[model samples]
Target: MTRTSAVSLIRSRTLSDVAEYAYAATAPAGSRLIFLAGACPLDEHGGTVAVGDYAGQAARAVANLRTALADAGASVEDVISTRVLVASARQEDLVAAWQVVRDAFGDHDVPSTLMGVTVLGYADQLVEIEAVAAVLDEPQPEGAACPPSA
Candidate 1:
């Protein structure tokens, strides 16, 4: 399922039959931008989750991305863009990975780029995702006392 969010997604009407993902996204002013490290398809034990399987690795990568976003006080809905890296020259392998990511984001459909790369850092790592997200900070109450500076 797809959904909209704080980031605005843009699609080109003139572009013919492009992929389902949006072509661009824009975050609003006053939104905090979060830059995340590339999320890898690794299990909690630091082992690659999917050996030689593009789709499986992509799924793990998305889960890792979610964890990273949570750590940064964001979620998939706040994502503004992503770069998907698949370790294969074959288009089908890239598509296999892209399908998993696209579905995971549902309609949030943040702007993204998919690339077939030569290799990734981890063993048997067929997919990785690097993401940028923006989230608005919660408003302070009127006359709210400010906390002491750390």
Candidate 2:
């Protein structure tokens, strides 16, 4: 079966030297939007994982993000935009986290914002990922009545 996503990424022709990401994204009407909570690098017991390691925390954060997306009936491919938070002043730390997230999305790179923050919610939490996704259902037959919300 063929697969489709609701988000359409937009690129600018004049900004060619920009990073490997879309400048913007749009979700058409009838698409179900999923706004996800920030995914943190926490373990099963609610404790932060990979303390003091940016890359390790980033990888865990990405994994948590995938799980959150699945629970929301979406995936990384359906993500329209993302905001990655790294608790550090160093660009290297941000890059370490960003590289993991960027590699996870691969070619379906959607619009993203990477930021450095002074702190995070959990103790020793080095990385967090917040995302918005859209789930699209096939268009109903023309003029068909809409289904009731659950």
Candidate 3:
């Protein structure tokens, strides 16, 4: 069996989550690391979840990240870091969006950063997110691709 851990690193209020910083850097040797491409606001059907809706987009992004993590043999608890990009200059909206992610990740840990981007891959997308997870296992299967679309 493999053991994993997470930690928090940021400390800010107002615009910050109550939990501040978090991380999951303690993994035994031979542990594998998974890097997932940024996930946008697209849903399983390849349709935008909530056009111009930052909070909705943020939730969808987290869901996609969770799926990818599971497929890669990791879990939300294994995540060590995350980068979130919101396509807007409104700091208040961004904070609300971040709250959605904070709720999804629960007590799991990871150091996370949020950014305000001018745009994303699609005009309908309001947010995009990427993550890094550490798992106790051999390397992932070579040439493995993302799970086939359902």
Candidate 4:
């Protein structure tokens, strides 16, 4: 018998071709959840990188997303959902941005939503992404030694 994992992928019963997303993600019990603010395509100096370049902006935004996750003691693998906003109506631009996001997420296959917008917070910003992650709390084995405090 194949064992099913606790991460349940919920989908609409009547919907077809919705494989790209999970309508709902149910994390395992005792999971620590973190919701990160929207990450923009700004560099460390607070300036947009590669203005007017959708793919470049997407890459920067994904990099910032990784930093945010690391700061919270989480990794991309912990991400359960993501919302990607692109400041363009063109399908090609949106696809370009999405490809960058897919590269960042790797094999996690987390649920994601991509949207096209007229504008964003920054004047030259082309992409913004926000994410939610669930860090599972693994139970320590009985009688395990605790590490010393720093």
Off by over 4 Å in 1: 1-4, 142-150
Over 4 Å off in model 3, which ranges? Answer: 1-19, 23-26, 138-150
Candidate 4 on 1-150: residue-level lDDT in tens?
322333445676777764566666778877778899999999999999989899999999999999998787677777888899999999999999999998787667677899999999997998999899887544569998753322
lDDT of each: 0.89, 0.91, 0.76, 0.82
- Report how far residue 115 has shifted in candidate 3, in Å: 0.4
List pairs with backbone clashes in candidate 1.
2-106, 2-107, 3-107
- Model 4 bad stretches (over 4 Å): 1-15, 18-23, 138-150
lDDT of 2 by residue, 40-96 (tens): 999988999898999999999899999988877678999999999999999999999
RMSD of 4: 4.9
The model with the greater lDDT, 3 or 4, is 4
Off by over 4 Å in 2: 138-150
TM-score of each: 0.89, 0.89, 0.77, 0.79
